[model samples]
Target: MKVPLEIRPGSDAGLGYVKYGNGPVHVLVMHDWLGDHASYDAVVPWLDGHALTYVFVDLRGYGQSIALTGEFTVEEIAADCLTLADQLGWGRFHVIGHSMTGMITQHIAADAPSRVTSAIAVCPVSAAGNRLSPEALTFFASTVDDDNALRRLFKFVSGGLSDEWADSKVQHSRATVAPACRRPYLDMLVTANFVDDVQGLATPFLVMVGDNDPGLDAKAMQRTFLAWHPNAELHVIPDCGHYPMQACPRYFATVVERFLKRHTT
Candidate 1:
């Protein structure tokens, strides 16, 4: 059955959302900056089987959500997130943020510790030593530039994935993206605090990343997080990249299910 989802105005942050699920635990699933609800299509089925409710949010300027002009800080997004949850009657819930949205999750965990039960930051963006981290920047610049290069890069990075698969995925991403929605998400990163933000956060956490992911120094970030907050655990999915939920749904679901079960209230 399709769950009823509605758009709720954020007053300041443009478009906000509210959706309901059936399980005792409610999860707010935040997508990568470029993604929409469709991004979860691969992982949702597995998540649905776990018998918990899920709320997938389209961040400001992405998908059906509206972008707040000028003042687009992560705090604004985070505030809208909590407000939307309140509007949905979710007194306490869990959050799972993927890719860039991981930054938003950290802001929430840091600011509203009492409302969130647990958080999973999946292949999240981290302190890159420098924003111009040459290798990582090259990966992103290619995606935003050369089409053929994007395909080759995808194949090279995702590893174990065939040429046909890589080509199709790249095509799908390029074809589906909203040309107008493409822009900066600096407010999000800024509001969340980069790299060392929310050290030793009290919120129980899980950090999952693909073995071949190049978004950040995955191993180093994981170690830094654990050193600061002893409550967090890390899971590395083999043969995957930044988009583990889509590239390795089965593995992603299993990891999430186990974590949710152990932490579910």
Candidate 2:
């Protein structure tokens, strides 16, 4: 089902969100850094018949929230998700965070343990943060101005998807984001750390990684999430890269559905 986008007051900005399904189980899906709620479009059909309610949200300066502005830090983003949940009158719910939002999910689970039922981090960045080298940071900063470079960067993330897909992703991102939000967020995601913040977090976690995803693999999850959370479990999706949901939507949805059924029931 389609719902009109509603803007809710976030910490220092406004967040836009849309809800789907009518199941009693409530889930909040956070978008990746590259795209907004639309990033999960491929998985929608798979969830269309499920007995769950899924809410897809856009961070400030992205998608429907493109006009909104904020600090864009992980902490602020996590707060926005909680605020949305409150607005929805959901006392507790599950969170499915992809890519950068994966990191944001940790903040949500860490900050409000009692409010979160479970967390699914799909191709997520660990809560401890991903420290990048000065050279790599410089290169990422450059992509803000260079579309071709940005497209090429996604190639690595997608493990070499078709040109059409890459172009569409680049176009959508450029149209929806401003450099002010993009640059600072990139800086934050690459350098921020929260090892102590998430220590001893008991929230049930389902960490999904793509076998072809270069940086965030099963091994990485083992070291970061598995080592940190005693209740966390990792699953590897084969023959796909960072965007497994997009690469194989049905399979991705099936895996997530199974996990939620097991834990959220």
- Model 1, residue 205: distance off in Å is 0.8
* Candidate 1 pairs with clashing backbones: none
- Candidate 2 residue lDDT tens string, 6-98: 334333434777677777889999887778788888888888444788888888888778877888898888888888888788988999998
**Residue 103 of model 2: what lDDT?**
84
lDDT of 1 by residue, 1-265 (tens): 7654444543453354444457778888887755565577777667653367787776666555644443456667688788768866888888988767776777788778898889898877642222445675556555655678677766765645777877777666565444444434632442344446677778888888787876444665555555655688888777777777778887788889889878977
Best by lDDT: 2
TM agreement with the true structure for every prediction: 0.80, 0.94
As for candidate 2, its clashing pairs are: none
Worst 10 residues of 1 by lDDT: 186-195
Q: How many clashes in each candidate?
A: 0, 0
Clash count, predicted structure 2: 0
Candidates' C-alpha lDDT: 0.67, 0.84
